[model samples]
Target chain A: MAELRKDYILDQYVIIAQERAKRPSQFSRSPPTPSSDKDCPLCPHNEHMIPGVLEQVGDGRGGWLMRAIPNKFAAVGQEGSAALSTHDPLFVHGLALGEHEVIIDTPHHDMEFEDLSVEHIERLLQFYAHRARVVESKPHVRYTALFKNRGEEAGASISHSHAQIIGLSVFPPAVARLFDRAYDYALRNESCPFCDVIRREKHSKRLIFINKTFVCIAPFASRFPFEAWILPLRHVPAMDKLRKEEFSDFAHMLRKVLRRLGTLGVPPYNLVFYNDERQGMFHFHVQVLPRLAKWAGFEHEVSVPINPVPPESASSFYREG
Target chain B: MAELRKDYILDQYVIIAQERAKRPSQFSRSPPTPSSDKDCPLCPHNEHMIPGVLEQVGDGRGGWLMRAIPNKFAAVGQEGSAALSTHDPLFVHGLALGEHEVIIDTPHHDMEFEDLSVEHIERLLQFYAHRARVVESKPHVRYTALFKNRGEEAGASISHSHAQIIGLSVFPPAVARLFDRAYDYALRNESCPFCDVIRREKHSKRLIFINKTFVCIAPFASRFPFEAWILPLRHVPAMDKLRKEEFSDFAHMLRKVLRRLGTLGVPPYNLVFYNDERQGMFHFHVQVLPRLAKWAGFEHEVSVPINPVPPESASSFYREG
Candidate 1:
C-alpha cells in the first residue's frame, strides 16, 4: 500500500505511501517567518547556502543576475530506481524518479518577476528551456512540468522569486488526458482544439491581449478568477521551438498581464507551462492562474470548480488596466 | 464567456462566471473570527437566520437534535434555468441548476462532530440520507454530493458542526469518471472494483477497523495524509440501502477512526460520500481526507498527488492509538 494508486476510472494517480509523512501537527500552517537579506539563501554572495548552481546569467557587474540549481529538497529525483510494483489489480505502483530544478528569477531578493527587464526575463526563459531539455533527455523522464508559485498562499516558502521545472518519469495524467482528447478531436474533426479556441476567441470579449504571433485570453472555462492563457497563433508543440521574436513576445505579454494583475492587488498566483514534443494534435501554451479562492470539500471531491469571476470581466479588467 | 466550461480533455467542469467575484484584495486569508453562542446563527434559538428546514430529528424534547436546511448562500441553485450553451467547438457552457442543503449535526453550538455520541452520529447520518434522497428526487438533479468540512483549513466558516449536501443538475465529473470506469471494469471482468479492493485489503496491513458488515482502511492511493475509507463488506451501491444495525456500525467505525486522527492532532479534514443508484457497476463508500498538506502548482496543473504518508503507517497509527 506504499505506492502510486491509479483511480479506477480516471487517469489520475496519487502517491499513497507514507515514507516522508509527518505528524499532523507538524503540517499545520504557521505564520510565515519573515526573510531579510542577511538570512535569505537566494541573496547574492550566498552561493554557499545553495548546494550548487547548474547555470547562471551575468549581472554585467561581475555578479550573477539569475541562476538555476537542483532543488535543495526535491519531491522526486533520479537517485531512486524506476521500478513498477503492482499489488493486485486495483493497486498500481512505480518508483518516483525525477529531477527538480529551481530557476531563481533574480539575485536581488526584492525584485519582482513582473518588474524584471525583458532581457533578464528572456534569460530566465532560456535557462528554463535549457534545463527542461536536459532533464527530458534522461532515460526515465517522460515529461517536464515548468511552473511558478508566488506568495505564501501559493506555497512559496522563501521570499525569493523563483520557478520550478520538474522532470517527471511519467506523463502527467492531465497532459495524458488532454493528448487523448486532442487526438480524438483531430481524428474526428481534422483540427486542433486549442487552435480553434484561439480562432473563436480572437475577436471576442474574452481576449486580453493579442500580438502578431501570440494571443492571450481569459479561458471560457477558467477555474480561477482572472485566469488567462498565452498561446501561439501558429502551432508549436514545444517551448524549445519558439523563434527569437516569439520568445521575446511571449515574455512581454506574460509580464504585462502579470503586472496588470499586480496593479489589481492579486495575491499569490501560479503560471504553468503546457507543451509537448508530440506533433499535430497538441499546441504549446502558458496558463496564468490567480489564486483568489480556497477550494473546499465540494471541489476536492468532485473535480468541478465554481469560479466566481467571468472571463469577460477578467479580460475587460486586463484590457482597461 | 460567463458559464460552466467542460475541460476539452478531462471530464472536468468549471464555472466561468462573475456572479460572486471578489476583488483580488478581498480574498486574503485572515485569522478565523471567533464565535459565541449569543451571536451564532446556527444556535438553537436562531431558526429565523436559516431560510427553511427540509428535515429535522427530535431529541425527544420540544427542540430538534438535528436539522437540514437550504443553504443561504448556494453556489448552484434551482433559480437558474436548466440548459446547455455551446459556444463554438472549444467553449461549452451550462446553466448551473441545483440545490444546496446544510445538515446541522446538533442543536448545541459547541459540540464536536467526532465527540458526538454514537446515537447522535447515527441520527446525523440518517438526516444526510434523507436530505440526499429528497434532493436527488428533484426534476433536474442527477446526483447529490454529501460532505462535511471540519476546521478552517477544511473550509468551514462556521464553528458549528454541520455537513452539506449539494444536488446538482449534472453528475460531477469525478463521479461520472468513476462510474464509467466501474462500468467498463464490470463489463470486462464481471466484477466490482471496490468489492475487489475490499477483498484485497481485508486483514491486510491497510486495514484499520473491520466489523461483520463494514471494513475501514487507509486507501492505497490516499490523496491526503491519514486519509481513510469505510466500505461495506457486502456490496451496496446506495447509502439508503443500509439496515439499522449496519448504519449504526458504519457510524461507530467512522467516529472511531476520526477520533483516532484527532488524538494524533490532525486538524481540518473533509469527509465525502460516494454512492450511486446504478446497479452492478458501483459500490458505496465514505472517504475521510485529513488536510495535512496544501496543494500547490504541480497538483493544480497535473491533478496527481504526491502523498507522503503510506497507508500502512496510517492504518497502524489508527489501530494502535
Candidate 2:
C-alpha cells in the first residue's frame, strides 16, 4: 500500500525501488533449466571422475562393502579447526572442518534410493554408524551431521542417491538452540516435544500412515508446503542406536514417505537428520521437505510467515494416498 | 563406491542411498503465474483484500504512499506464549512474537523495487524511522528485522518490489549467536566488528562504491555468489539513526549494487537487513545476496559451507563491473 517513494529529507539520489514493479505472475515461478549441472557423475564408472574416493569396501584387495569419497565440489571438506581464532566476533572464518563423503549405494546406475532393499538400508546405516564413530572422536568434532540431499532445490548437486557426512568441529548455533528447546520440553514435561507430536498425530486420526514401527505425518506447523517427517515410534537417539528389532518398519515407513511425495507431484526435496551429542537423544529422524513453492528473499531477512496451504489441509490430501 | 547392500550387515531393511542413481529433475522451469483474481490479492487495487493493514501514510484516506499490512500466508507468526511458556532453563521458546509488515515500493502495478528515486529512499527511511520508534516500544519485542525478498526464488510472492519489517518478541537463536560473536569480538578487540569490516573493506579494493557516508562491498567470506553489503561509514547501531547527510551514498550504493546484479545475468536475489536489539556495538547493515542457490537439508542440519562460486571470485567478478 506504500508509495514507491517518500518525499523525505534523505532524497538526495535516485531510489531505484521507487519505480520498480512486477505483476503477480512474476513472483510465482522459477526459470526452467535453472543454471546448474545436469551431469550424473556418481555412476559406477563415473565415480572415478568425481572427487577422488577416500575409502572403499569392495575393490577385491579386501572386498570391503563400502567406500567414502570426497564430494567432487565440496562445500566444506575434511579440514579446518574449531578454534575461534579471529578476534572479530561478528565475522569469524576458519576451515569448514568436516568430512564430505559420497556413498555410492550400489554399482547399479539408475535405481532410486527408496527402491533399495531393506538390506541396502542396513548397510547404509552401518556406514553412517562407522563414520559417526570415527568423526565423533576427532578432537574438534562436537557433532557429526549425516544427511542426504536428494534434489537441487534442496541443495543437491549430483543426481546420485548418496548420504553425506559433515563432522562439525563446533556446534551449529541454530541446531543447539533447537536442541535446547526440545530438551527444555523434555525437562519440563518429562517427555520429548517430538515424542509428544508422534503420539498426538497418531491419535488425532488425521494421521497419514503407521507401520508397526515408524510414524509419518505432516507436522502441525509445517514451515514449508508438503513437509513430511519420519520419526521412530519411540525415542532413539542416533541411527546406530536403532534396535535390531526396529529395522523393518523403519525402513518401510521411510520409503513410503518419500514415495508419497513423488505421488503428490512434488519433484525436488531435501532430507535432514539431526544428531544431538549432548542428549545422546541424538534422534535419527528424517525430515523430507518438498519444494512445492519458492523461498523468496523475505524469509532470509524476516523468518517467513507463509500460509497459502496449511499443513493440516495438505496432510489429509497426503493421508488419502 | 559403497554398495547399497552390504554382505555382512545383519538386517537389510534400512533405507540406503544408491549413489550414481537417477535423480529426477521435477521442478517446472516455466515461471508459475497466478491463476485468477483469487490467486493474487496483493495487486494494488486488491491489497486490502488480503489481511491486516496496520497503518498508512497515503493520500490521508487510501491513495497512499505507505501502509503496513500483515501477510496472508505467514510461515512465521506469533505462536504467543502458550507453547513456549515455561521459565525452563534447558530449552527456549518465547513468543515467536515478531512483526511482519510489507512496504509496498510503488503505486504502479509493474514497477520493481529497485526503481525508486533518491527522494523515495529518504522518505522510506523516514517511514521506517517512525515504525521503528513505535514498534520498539511494543511488549516483548526485542529486535526488529527489515529486509526485502526480490525474485520468486528470493521468495517474493507478488512480483511487487517491497521490503518488510519484523519486530520479534524473542530473538531467533541464530541471530543471538551473531550478537554473541559480536560481543566476544568486542571484548577481545575493544571495538565493533562491523566497524572493523568497514575500515578493512574500505581500504581493501573490495569496495564497490562509497559516497561520503555509506560504503558497499562484497564481504570477505560471502556465503552466496554476488553477495553485496551496504554498511554506514559510521558505526551507528540502527538505520533510523542515520542523518539526512548520509542519504546520498546510501541511495547511490544501494542502486549500484542492484544494477550490477542485473548486469551479471543473475538479476534475482534477496536483501537482508539484520538488527540486534540487545547489543551495544553491532551496527545494522544490509546484506544483498544473489539468489544463485538454495539451502538443502544438510545446510539446515549443519551450518552451511556455501561455495561453487567463492566470495573472492564473486568480488573479482563484480568489481570488474
Candidate 3:
C-alpha cells in the first residue's frame, strides 16, 4: 500500500520499498532477560519503592489492574516557575517544570502489552485518557506526551509493562512544527490531511489492519523498519476526546498491531502517542518505531532516514500468520 | 561550562547540566572486539573485497594510509534520474540518486581514531575534503555528508576503523532548516550566529580544547551526554575551504578531545561532518555524539531530549587527565 512518501508539507522524504537492504530475519537479537517478581519494583507488593500512587484501577479483588505513580527519578519537576529567561543571546532556558508519571499496565512483572487481554488493554487506554486529561489540566502544562518504552534497548530502566506521561511546560518544537504543517495543509486542502491519508491508505498496499473505528498502516514515510501508525477514523484531536465506545476498537487495533510486531523477535520499540493539548488541527495517533536498527552518523547529520525495509514488505510481514 | 541554551533562531531548547543523574564512570561498557586483520575486508591485503578504489593516500611504505571505495550495499544509487515525482498528494518520491562510499581509515584493523597520529588524521581529513569535492561536482548532487560510526552501538557494521561519505541529489531538510535559521540570524545580527557562538564560548566553561586554528567545546545545548563540537577559529563554510595549515590544528583538537572521551571506556559514538556543498553562509563543524544512552519514546515524540549529564560536567570530564 505504501511507496516513497514525502512529508505532506515538509521536504523530508522516506524512500520506501524501492530498495530493501535487509529483511526482517536479519534483525533478530538475543532475547532480553525478564525481571522476576521477587525484586521487581513495579510488582504488586513493592508499592513502597515508588513515592506514591497518583491513581489506580482496582481489579475488584482487592488488587489493582493498573496504577499511576510519579516517576521516582523524574526528568522534569514542578520545583521552579515555567517562565523562560535569557542569560545571553545564546543561552536561554526555562525551568524543567511540570510532571512525569508512570502507569503500571499490569501486575505481572514479566507481562508485555501484547500479552494483555483486549478488555484489559481497553481499560489501560481509558486510564491513559483519564491521566492525560488530569496532567493537561495543570496550569503550567502546555504539552503532554504519553508513551511506552518496552525493553532495555527502548530505554526502559525497569522491565515491567508500563507507560509514561510527561507534562511539559513549554510546547515542544516538533509538535509545534507538526501543527504548523497541518494548519497549512488544511488551509490548502480544505480538509484534515490525516483524514485524507486514512481514506487513501485504507485501500493501499501498506495497510496492515483496518476496522470500523481505527486503521493501522505501515507509514509510507516510515523512519524505521516496520514503523506503523494507528489512527482513529474519526478526527480525534487528542486521546481525551475519544468516546467511551471508541476505546475498545482502538485498544484492539493497538494490541493486534503490536502482536504482529512480536513476529520480529519481540524487538525493543517505542510506542508514542501524539496528542495536542491546545486542540489544534492535529490528528492524535500512536506511532510504533521498532529499534531494529541503530541510527548512525548520516541519520543524525542529514535528518533523513533511509528505511531498509519498504512499507509494503513490512505490511506483508505484519499480514503474515 | 555549559547551561541551558536555545537554538539561535528555532524554539528548540536543550537543558544543560542542571541535573547530575549519572556520572561518567556509570557509562562504562564492555570493550568492543577488534576484528582480526586476516578476515577484515578493510585490511591491507583485502582491497579486492571492495568493488574499486575511488581514491587512496600513499603511506610511502608500499602501503595505503587511507582508501575510498564504493559501499557494497549502498543506501542510494546513481542508476536513476534525480528528478522528484509525486504519485499522489500523499505518495511523493524521488529516485535515491547519488553515491555512498566508505573510507578505510587505516590498514591496521585494530586501530581507532584516537590512536592515529595527528599527521595521519590530517591526511584522512584531506582525503575527506577531496572526496566531498569530487562528489559535489556531479550535476545532480546537492549535499554531501561525511561521518564516522565508531562502534556497533554507533551503527558501525564492521569492527575495522572507517568513515563514510554520502552524496545526495536532494538537500537534507535538517541542514536546510539550519541554513534558514542561520540566514535569519545573519539578516538580523549582520553576522554569522556560529561565529558569535565561537566568540562567546571560547573561554566559556564548556571549552574543552583549543589550538591556534580550531576550538572544541561541549555545546551548551547538547542532545547527548558529553557531546562535543569542533569548529575552526576562522569561519569556514566547508571543509574544502580549510587552509592547509588549519588541518593540523583541527586534527590535534579532534584527537585530544576524542582521547578525553576515551576515558569513559571509549563509549561508542558518531562523528558527523556538517559541510555545506552549496558554500552558502554556513559554518562547517564536526559533532561527536557518544552513544551512552538510548533515546526513548519521550525523546522521539517530544523532540526535546532530556540530557542527564550537563555539558559543563562533560567539559570537566573531557578536561581531566
Candidate 4:
C-alpha cells in the first residue's frame, strides 16, 4: 500500500509507494566510469577544441580555477536562425533563440562538487550569478535557468564537473505555475508561502539542517527519496540578490548538504534553482533531487510521483545517529 | 542549434535539441532479461501467488488466456488506512486510497504487445474497460488510469506483457490542466480544442495513419523522439464509452502502430489513455511515447522537454518506404 502525500504548501502530490520501499543499499550502483582526459574537450589544455571561452576565474596563482564556455554542441545557440514566432493553430515552432553556456567548475577533471573547497565553491557561485545577470539582461529573455547534472545517470555526457545556464524567451511553465500559486497564496494570506513553510518545518521531523542564513529539509511531499530543499532565511527574490555574507553562508550550507548526500553513496543528483518570476512574487530556493528510480508511464501521465522512502526517514538519515 | 516547438493546442512546450539528435541505432539497448517462469507470479498456474484473482479471460478450451489480479506489491491498495482528509497549513497527507490491478495479456513470459494477435489484444482492452468500470463505481475514486510499460527501459520490472489500472481519488494535475485548457477553449471558441487539432493536422505532413475510426500522427509538439497519438475519428468522451465496434477498430489501429514501431527497432515505449475526465468536456485519445532519451535537470525543472528528433522526421519514419 502507498500513502498519497501532498506538499505542505504547493499543489504537488507524491504517492509514497511504501509497498515498493527501497533501502539505501538498493540505490548503490556502479561508480561512474572516468573518461580519458586526452580526448575530453573540457580538459584544461584542450581549450582550443571548444569554440571559445566566455569567462574564467583565477585560482590566485595566475592559473584558472573554473571556466565558462559555449557548449560545443549548444542546445540553444546565441546565434541561431531568427525566431519563427509562429502562432499556428496546428503546428508552431520558434527559433530556440537563447544562450546555452557550460560552467566548468574545476580544472581538475575528476573533482566533483563535494570535493571542492568552500572558497572554490563560492567563486563558482559568483560566476553563476554573473552569467545569470548577463543572460537576464538579454531582450525578450524572460527567464534564466541554472542547473547541474552530476553523474552519467543524471544525464551528464561529459565526466567533467560542470553546470549549465540556459536563457529562455518565455518564463518556464514549471516556475510559472509556482509563481501563480505563490501569488494566489499571498493575495489571500498576506504572507509568502515558503516563509510559512520554513516556520512550520521547524516543528516537523523533515528538517535536516538549519543555520542562521539557510535551512535544508526533506520536503513534506518529496517526489524522490532524500529529496532536499535549501531556502534562504531572508525573503530573497533570486540568486543574484544574495549579498557577500549571504553567499558565503549559502556556500557553506550547500557544501555540507552535498557531503551528507555523499555519505549515503548517492552522487547522481540534480540541482535546480528557482527564482521569483522577475516580479518578486515567490521565494528563491534550490531543489536537490536524486535520480534513484526511473519514471514509468503512470508517473509521466499523472505528474504525481510514487516515492518509496518517506521524507521523515531521509531527514533522520541526514541527521546521523 | 535547437528549436522550441509548442503543442498544437495544449500549453506544452518542447525544445527540439537538434544538436543532440540521435539516430535509431543509438536507442538499441539490451532487451530485458526474462525472469524464469517458475518464479514469475503473473505466469499461468502461478496465480496463487497474487492476493486474489479479480477477472480472467478463458480460451475456447476453458483454460485462462488472460487474467487480472490484484498487484501483489500494489502502489495504492484497497485496504489501507483511511484518508487523512487533512488540509494542514504546512503538512497535508491522504490515504493513497484506491485500487491497483494487473491485466496479464499473455500466459507466455516472453510475449510482447506487438507480437499479440488482434483478438488477444481486443480481450486485453475489454479487461481494461471492465476493471475501469469497477473502479469508477467506488466512492471517492474520481478517475482511473490504464497504462502499459512495455520494456525495461520504460520501467517494466517484469518481462511479461501486462498493463496496470490505477484508480485515482483526485483528478491528476496533468489532466486537470488539460481540462482547464479545454474548458477555456470551449468557452472562447464553442468547440473542443482537440477537435480543432484533428481538423488542422489533416493539412500537415505529420499524419502517419488514418482510417474510418482512428487517426495516428506525430504530435506537433512532441516531447520525445517518435512520439505519436491516436484519436477517435468520432468524438468520444471516454474509453469505457467506446462501443464494441469502436473497440475492435482501436485494437486494430493499436496493433498496426506497435508493429510499425517494432520495425523501427524501438522496443521501449509508454502508452497512456486520456478519457473525458468524466466531465464529457474533452476528447478521448491515446498517446504513444517512446522512451528514447533521458530527461535531465533542465527538463525536470522547466517542464519543457528537449526532444532530439522533430515530429516531421518521426512521421516520415513511421511511413517508411
Q: What TM-score goes with each of the models?
A: 0.87, 0.74, 0.97, 0.95
- Classify candidate 3 by CAPRI docking class: medium
Interface RMSD score of each model: 15.9, 15.8, 3.4, 1.6
TM-score of chain A of each: 0.87, 0.79, 0.95, 0.94
**Candidate 4 local Cα displacement, residue A49, angstroms:** 2.3
| C-alpha RMSD in Å of predicted model 2 compared with the true structure | 10.6
Worst 10 residues of 2 chain B by lDDT: B6-15
Better of 2 and 3 by DockQ: 3
Q: Pick the candidate with the highest lDDT.
A: 3
**Winning candidate number (TM-score):** 3
lDDT of each: 0.73, 0.60, 0.84, 0.81
Q: DockQ for all models, in order?
A: 0.19, 0.20, 0.57, 0.69
How far out, in Å, is residue B62 in model 2? 12
TM-score of candidate 4 on Cα atoms, chains taken together: 0.95
* Best-to-worst ranking by lDDT: 3, 4, 1, 2
Instruction: For residues A249-298, write the lDDT of model 3, one tens digit per residue.
Output: 99998998898888767789999998866855788899999988788998
Task: After superposing candidate 3 on the true structure, give the runs of residues whose Cα lies further than 4 Å from its correct spot.
Answer: A1-4, A17-20, B1-4
Model 4 achieves a DockQ score of 0.69
Q: Residues A1-321, candidate 1, lDDT per residue (tens digit)?
A: 112222222333222212323332232343344467787778877879888988888878898877888887666656665654444346555556677789898988877899898887877777777777887888888778888988767767677889988777767666787778777776777887778778888888999999989999987666776789999898888788888898888888888998888775436788888868645357888888887656678777776665656666778878887
**Chain A in model 3: its TM-score?**
0.95
In the predicted model 1, the residue pairs found to clash are A17-B309, A17-B310, A18-B309, A18-B310, A310-B17
State the lDDT of candidate 2 residue by residue for A162-271, as single tens digits: 77876665566556756766666677778777777776778763367787778887655455566677778878887667776566677777777766666643367777
